[model samples]
Target chain A: MASVLRPAAISRQTCSLVSNRTALLQQASRTRFSETLRTSYLLRESRCLSTTQRKSPSRIPSNDPVAAPFHTSARRQILPPGPQVIEGGVNDPAPVPPTSPTHGSYHWVFERAMSAALIPLTIAPFAAGSLNPVMDALLCAGIIIHSHIGFQSSIIDYVPDKRLPKTRAFFWWALRAATVVVAIGFFEFETNDVGLTEAIKKIWTAKRKEDSYVEPVLRGVA
Target chain B: MISQRFTQISARRVFAQRSISLTSTRFSAPALITACKPLTQSRPAATQTVPEDEAYSILKAQRAVRPVSPHLTIYQTQIPWTLSALNRITGIILSGGFYVFGAAYLVSPLLGWHLESSALAASFAELPTAVKLLLKFGVALPFTYHSWNGMRHLVWDSGRQFSNKMVVRSGQVVIGLTVVSSGALAVYGL
Candidate 1:
């Protein structure tokens, strides 16, 4: 009887010991799986850093000093794809914008310079109340250029490429065409007529009958 | 009878002890609980599966596809932006006003009011000197401000006066020039 009991007791002790060992092994594996995940994350971060560093130098060309800083590639960094998704959820990464330089700093600078030049161009005419051909030509040129710049800026603000790309392009070209036509008409008027400012002065100073508009009324009255 | 009841209670106690020993696995220790807490807490609850209704999903998708531009109110008002906006406003008003007056002058003859009519010139000539000066100032003020501000923007185009100090300085200078020049024109009728 004693011998039989001893074998049963030993078997029970071994069973408990086996379970404890298996539990310990599971714990160790769980820790190792976590460590591998952490190491992979570190590796991914370093890879991203190296890629951005490598791409920047190539993207910013040496010739384009004005566009170097503002280029889309230089301004933004692409993030890595996220971990796997379990659910049928919307996990699409954000859209990556295409890289291109639309305009240079010099373009904006020229717009501003034209604006400054208009001050003297407009003021002298108003103050003198006379029409000199040189001043009139300068005035016409300045007005056309200034309006073109102003309209372009408005177009850029209200009609961004991201929202309405086609409309933006269409309006931009339309503005250019309109500016050209208007400039041509203005030059014709400035040269053939007494000129813009002098014409305005004439309207102010003319007598009721002598005024051009009054000639038709006088003819009708008779 | 008492001895029999004692034995029954002892037997039940032994059964409870066996069940307790079976349930208490080594993995369920206090150390394991602490280790698991950090893992659970590190990830946010939103990372878990969140069931959404079809309507909600559609709305979210729409918002994602057509994201709105930031509103004008979001930005802090600065001198250059404010002045530039004013310049555009004044420019539109001045030009529109000119076209309207010119059109009126052209059509006045058909209505029996002639552009060169002595009555109109007489009415204008009879206005009090102060009222005329005020009227002249009103017209001159917008033109002067717009022109001066345009000059400031032009200076900005030259890549100078871009810094905060220079921008502010130029803005002050423009305002000063507008006030001085317009006041001189109004008072002296230059």
Candidate 2:
């Protein structure tokens, strides 16, 4: 409504509604003004009041239901973790600088694409009837990276920068170190042991170690 | 005529006094006082004049009385949040297992432990049938559930079936699939 109303657009005949209470008080105080000037001023005030007709911003419909209730200050003051509205006036934007979509728009796409890609990589080894070393490596890398990203996101959400900056930074570094160590461990397992998929397969099928080499089709590699 | 005119004036004064008496008797004292109150209104809450800077501290003190919004306790046990929590737990289990096993494997050369494929197979073979089945089921359940729900999350990322009904239904489907599939894998030991 502030943006809607234009003070400069005030007509010569109509009331200058932008004129503050002091302006009205000044007019009321002046003894030199005739009855005609007083009548015009009173008429202008009445015209302005009649035009508005008790309209307010709250009366305007808003699409955002959650925010609509807190649009007013008194109700907003009751919100949790202390008053969010206390930092600024009701119409003020958040303290953070405006972010550009170009910086992070592809992040969602990349994450989704990577997550989707892992699904195929999971079954491709089994589908091929024999686990290729390259495919196995791919699966391990994908799963590890996916898990790392997932954990990172979880930490970011649970440990916000605003409340616990130091804690968040510590966790961030700890997660990075853990991820690196985990990658090295995965590499060792892949290179030396029967690899991730094959090892899981062997463990799952292990009975009495006598038939430990049996495949999905009951073919013995022994 | 003069006596009649004086009587009229006395009668008017008497009527005014009677009305005041009636008002006092009919209404409560608060109502009478409200009625007598002038056009200029007094504030509802008692206030003291304070410095502008000091006023902020009063506001801060008042703000402290309010509880945080959307508290976990305030929410009823709902499917979407419950499933999301399960997903987090399962993810933790899976990833944590991966990291632990990976680290152990990396350090195995230094520890001189036999973490070889044959060694693992033989050790796993030693476990009782029930234990083996339990372990397989435990591992498989989380894997299948996480896999299925992760797919559901992928679908959500694509911005389809976003309604509460779809999410609840999908979560149920994920749970059902996990139970059936993991149980089958456990029994078959495949």
Candidate 3:
């Protein structure tokens, strides 16, 4: 009886050992295959990969939801860490620095200030009726500069250098020329005509002494 | 034997009642759930367009690559951007005021009005001192601001005072000068 029991126990132990070895061998081969699959996925680096090609059912049990390929695409469609160029043969543009050199851009501050100043410079004379050459000259300079800046800003906002590079250049030069002509005309008015303030004042109280008339036309007749 | 059987049947009835009461309390929640289950099951399942997912991804990618302007909503507004925007706004206001007023002045001659007349002058003089001062100040405020800001801009054009600290400092100085100068002009003009 002891001899029979010993042989039976020995056979049971051997069978268990053989089964354990086979399981381990199977697990090793699965892990090796999964590793190879992962490397292939990395190499392909394709934007779109089919579920069967991408997923490897390594750790998940066969009955698990993730072990199947049905929802693999949904799981894979996650936002990447940063911008990814999925499409082939596309290169990102190099980063460009800002055009303005200043930090807070004092020019912008000054521009605002100038615009604010024009209100007082203009109205003080209108309210007071005190027209001096000094005031006129100042007004002349302020109006010219202020208007130029305003027009320039409008041009810049509308005509970006990126879209119409040459047009932008042309407009800039044209604007400068226009500004020069306007400035000259204003200066001429300042020097020659009843100055800007006086002219405005004259216009304000201007009275029409006569009815509007056109010169009588004469034509040659037989 | 009949009495014994009757006693057993009574005990059995009490035990059954107690079990029914306890189990009813315990399963009441599950019963409510079971009641709701049929209603949910009656509804049709949602269908998905699986094939269009590829097209959706491609469209999404295209959107990601598309060039878009930096809209005002997304960016953090800074002093430079704000101030520049204000400058443009003020410029428009000032220019518009000039054009409108100038046009009115030009057309006044045709309308039979004396702009330089003594009556108009006398009327202006008749205005209260406070009103006069207020008007002068109103005029001076814009003048002072615009002039000082323009100076700050000129300094910038020269490529000096480009640092952050300098910009802030200069901004404060410009405001200070505008206030002081405008106040002085307002008083003197009044």
Candidate 4:
């Protein structure tokens, strides 16, 4: 309004409710201020305030030559909680993520190495023409680990933590616990009974109806 | 008097740029430089500045009506993507199987379940030959395909074999390998 600053007692209160960025944005939106007062100066000034240190309102000069600010009873507007939209705009920068070989490229390398290792592992027993129980258990565990990683990726992609926080967390921990239990099962089968590979071999060669010593058929075979 | 007043504004204009970024510093420095500036900007009464939150509210209203990003169902299927989809599906099947069997095996010791190779084998052997081959083929299809396609993925991850032709060719090769190996296993194992 043309009456931008009236001759009134302006309160100098430290802005405690909203961020300085909000205040800065509010100030920037009024481009007409520069048009009426110092042409084009405030327009350029507001833009440069987007830097990190601008959040501190302590730097605003308490005194100046201009007309004084006054207290108004009108309520200031605030952003509402949207369902999918996240907090902060492009100006608000994310925290710098910590980087190391273990969290970065090495994880990728480890995945590839594990995948490459599996190829040799798959052929090793067949090339030697023997079913070593230890070798069989190791391979099964390797596959489980590989599967666990893949499943985790799927969970990350589909059950995003942003959209479904609780469900994502549940699926993650459940998968981890399930993986550990399955590993245990695989090991037990290997130690106390004929392991996974041998079970496949036996089934492939199995020939008769009356061969089971147990009376009931097993359910839930993976 | 008018010329003198214009001269002061011209002088202030010369140094306005240096103080542009400094809101607090700009006010405090008038003593040092005598740069005359108004305490408040004088805006016209007609146009108004919408608060940041109000602008966001307008944006939020627009977004609520905006269509979401299209899901995979809207996609046109092709060979490469189909093969990629199948690879993932097979991976899920294989991993899911391992989890189930692993749990069963773990509890087998406690339950007195004869999940030993011979017992499971004998149980499976009771099925008719056709059913047996069919079962093997069904399981084998996913297993063999997933395994071979996994190698293809590993190769692709290395940033090689990314051409459209190579992807299609490799996919076909994987399918062929799966059929031949799975068929041989079913027949020979039988």
Candidate 3: which stretches are off by over 4 Å? A1-142, A158-194, A197-222, B1-82, B113-123
Worst 10 residues of 2 chain A by lDDT: A64-73
DockQ of 3: 0.03
**Whose TM-score is greatest here?**
2
Task: Find the candidate with the highest DockQ and give its number.
Answer: 4
Clashing pairs in 1: A112-B154, A208-B116, A208-B117
lDDT of 1 by residue, B28-95 (tens): 34333333322111111112454567445544443332213344555798776777777887776665
- DockQ pick, better of 1 and 2: 2
Comparing 1 with 2 on lDDT, the higher-scoring candidate is 2
lDDT of 2 by residue, B1-69 (tens): 998875654443333334435565665444544554222211222247999666666666545433345
Candidate DockQ scores, in order: 0.05, 0.17, 0.03, 0.23
RMSD of each: 20.4, 17.8, 23.9, 15.9
Over 4 Å off in model 2, which ranges?
A1-91, A100-103, A210-222, B1-65, B111-114
Model 1 Cα lDDT, one tens digit per residue, A34-129: 554443333322333344433323333334222111111112123221221223346866666675444665665576667777777776866788
Residue B5, candidate 4: C-alpha displacement in angstroms: 34
lDDT of 1 at A166: 82
- Model 1 lDDT, full chain set: 0.55
Candidate 1: misplaced stretches above 4 Å? A1-106, A126-128, A200-222, B1-22, B25-80, B91-139, B156-166, B183-190
The residue-by-residue lDDT of candidate 2 on A1-222, one tens digit each, is 111222222221112222353454345334223433333333322323344443433433343121112111122223335232256655988798577664467766777777898898877755764467888888889888888888888998877776567888999999999889889988888887777788877877878744555444375334
Compose the digit string of candidate 4's lDDT tens values, residues B42-159. 2223356899987776655544433343445567887798989898889899889879888888888789988778878878888998999998888888888888998999999999
